[model samples]
Target: MAETVQAATLRADVAIIGAGPAGLFAAFECGMLRLGTVLIDALDETGGQCAALYPEKPIYDIPAHPAIEAGALVAALEQQIAPFAVPRLLGRRIERLQGSRGAFSLGTDHGDSIHARAVIIAAGAGAFGPNRPPLPGLAAYEQTGSVQYYVRRKEAFHGKRLVIAGGGDSAIDWALELREIALHITLIHRRAKFRAAPERLAQLEAASGPGGPIELVVPYQLHALHGDGGTLASVEVATLEGDRRRIEADHLLAFFGLSTDLGPVSQWGLQSALHHIQVAPSTCETSLPGVFAIGDVATYPGKLKLILQGFSEGAMAAHAIHPIVHPHTALHFEYSTSKGAPGSRDAPGSLAGAGHAPRPAAA
Candidate 1:
């Protein structure tokens, strides 16, 4: 659930620039501290890539849970932040970021403005898109859904022959996932060694044996596509040794990872490198005071690009922003179990009573 913002200029103590897992968790953390917050994202939903791209994908690294789908994890986060009744400005991109420290003004692409005392940037990979393979007639197949970069719906490929390409976890995991539903699968990679976890690699190796559902093709790179009228028939592969082979396939799923850009965020005057914002590890604060970055968009000396790490970063960012929002009050850190969660918009420590923005709706 999300609250719509109809005001010309919305105000909050903290403005979160991405409503992904990290941003969502940051809202909860800020609410826990009694700081009014507003969630903003280009996408019209709270979950970001988890809900948009790989909702069906299973995440194994989340703490406590053995395995949970990406969408389910997002839902749990939504539930965690529901009590705050946080207002969300979705489907709007923050284009211009001006002002500083205790006073910041953000202009969105939708011509709306957000006034905040502090900002937390949790934009994971910023604006991201899949890295597509350079193959002839690729656009035709892509238009026909024969060549796909995201597996949003697994049932659509049921009983269909698939050519899964890449060496990373996305390729290997999808190969293993679709093996049960796909009629046959050909896993192609330029390297024999895959970049997945040891356990997943072992599973892939076991599933690629003779008479198995998956056939592992090593040292092979995609060369061409043999198809007509946006319909795929077979895929051509080649080795550096000049050896070429053609494998029959109905569709091609290329998971070569994502090509990400920081977009307008790079021009915000914050220290950045390789499309990532530099932030202090302890406070998740960027070079500019009152501005912070977390999740995959933030980088430091040693940063692990994991969702679990993003959650921790969000807490650090929220705690750091607390003093800026309430400089007169001393923050006495306490466990959540002791403080308990805020119940409603009018509850003690809720956003409504914080005297920042009006309550839009219950999230």
Candidate 2:
């Protein structure tokens, strides 16, 4: 594999970016080996995407557990690492990564840097989000610097007339949160009907209640953004009735989509997509030697992007390094299942003969 060193720091045994299950499991493996490790994430706390995106949603495929909510599962994984003091660098974005497989430097959006001996980038696809309106010139605006993703701080958009695009969760959600800070918000969506849950939509409608001066433009599509001196001034939009209108605004916020680009690591000479990282089968190593990939971001010959599979990968990757880390450890972890006669220590507890059980939900 080729090498591209766009890092901003240097020196570490292992640096795993992302506190998702995969990265957490990687830290677990490193803990088993007593190796120094660090986990970096953009969120203010642990649990990554699950904590932010869908904490209430039930996750069905975690091994042995029939169903678990994102937050609950994250809490459990955190408990698993309670005894292992893995360093966590939270609330920052990866600015750049550079150097060879064993050693790399990492830069962040929060004006800090770290070095690592190896890195496992499990940044799930599309973190910074997209510049919305889904039109041509917005792309140019995004490239030339007239649009924004997540709000940086309270003062960034203060006193600025803003046009927020989309009716999705983030669109309305962020709008509601930032309304106090924004001068004005123009909520625009292509469809009259929204995809947000009924409760959220209703809450938004009530929050921007009657007599409230919230601007909503439905069945409209923004055609272009006309600005001067690289500063956003106004936008031209086409309505459902074939009427074109222009609106003045100081900033544009698009929460309709997400765009992700594989950083310099992709050029590592491995054949993979711009949104995904590929690793070798069986060992979880990338095309580059000593460099490994894991979690939802990893794709190999035969791999599934589930937490359970990631757990297996983390364990396997640790096993792969056992020779270097713990030469005397056995090839596999010990497991014992109870399946035997009654009164035997190996017998699994069963209610079949001891008591009657209520009917459960359909299996």
Candidate 3:
């Protein structure tokens, strides 16, 4: 399902795949370099997993701000790229990748062709889905929204009893996030030790008490879901000794992480291992010329799976790609502070100084 754009075949200096944090930043980087970029994603909207999964999740590592919600970060990125007016082909996946450096062709799932000088694959865990727990009558509950994998809306869980099961960040984060909205919150994990940020774990522990906002049920695994029709009544958990306990709840959030598949990306003739594309660390370019991989889907020696690192990689890839896009010209590197972004107050011939609005850059 591709959005109706100005033309059936879109052309650009760079065609970015994924539309996640890295992809969005790549668009901004390309725009700063005065290159036309188009963002394409399989999801209907931008922001990728951050928008789809946990929009309310807080990220502490992003530079500048001490803490920011995932959704807010996406919004800031969108606003940063507003002046460029980068074309977005949403609800579509790039299925085919062909051609070489400086001249590449891409075909999407919805019968759309995109021609670009360079391609950047910033896909984070390409084509991801949640890993659901195996429980009887789970489908019925899921159909009724009694059991959910992703928290798209926080208001839906307001005043409800929630039984969160998992030991990862998603489980703990949501437990802390929904503690205020939920009438009662119980987090059940098979292990007492949880894998999450220390500060977040401390926050969860601080709020947890015998009969406070949240309850911690450790060393207990989900045994079964007891419900009537599609309305969840309670969740049954058991220990290694087979001792079981039932926690009354209206909804169950199982966050076992994601089961990711590279899907069409692996079939794009790029070198890949364990569903991760192999790329050169310096340029982030894949084995296939003109195509680069970044973010979680890209793999290299000493690669850190961090959002900030992906941002750096996007900058590196853009600089590397400058030569390919403008073969005759040389790129004289300049800091963003020295060269203000187009349409900014500091930029030459800015709309602010001209007393008129700036038009959107062509994509």
**Evaluated with TM-score, which candidate comes out highest?**
1
- Kindly report which residue stretches of model 3 are placed more than 4 angstroms away from their true locations once superposed: 1-7, 344-363
- lDDT (Cα atoms) of all candidates against the true structure: 0.88, 0.64, 0.85
Runs in model 1 with CA error above 4 Å?
3-7, 344-347, 358-363
**Winner by lDDT:** 1
lDDT comparison, 2 vs 3, better candidate: 3
Lowest-sum lDDT 10-residue window in model 2? 352-361
Prediction 2 global C-alpha lDDT: 0.64
Q: How much does each candidate deviate from the true structure in C-alpha RMSD? A: 2.8, 13.2, 4.1
Per-residue CA lDDT of model 3 for 256-341, tens digit only, reads 99988777888888998877899999999999999988898899999999999999999888888878887776878878877776
lDDT of 2 by residue, 1-363 (tens): 011123233334667777788878777666544445567777777776677655655677888889897778888877665444555767766767767655566777765566655666666662544545556556666765567765535467777788877778777766766677777878888888777868778767876766553577778877778886557889777887888877798877777666655455454565565457777778776766556677777787677777888777776665565444334645444332333332233322122221211111132
| TM-score result, candidate 3 | 0.90
Q: What does the lDDT read for residue 164 in candidate 3?
A: 97
Q: TM-score, each model?
A: 0.92, 0.54, 0.90
RMSD of 2: 13.2
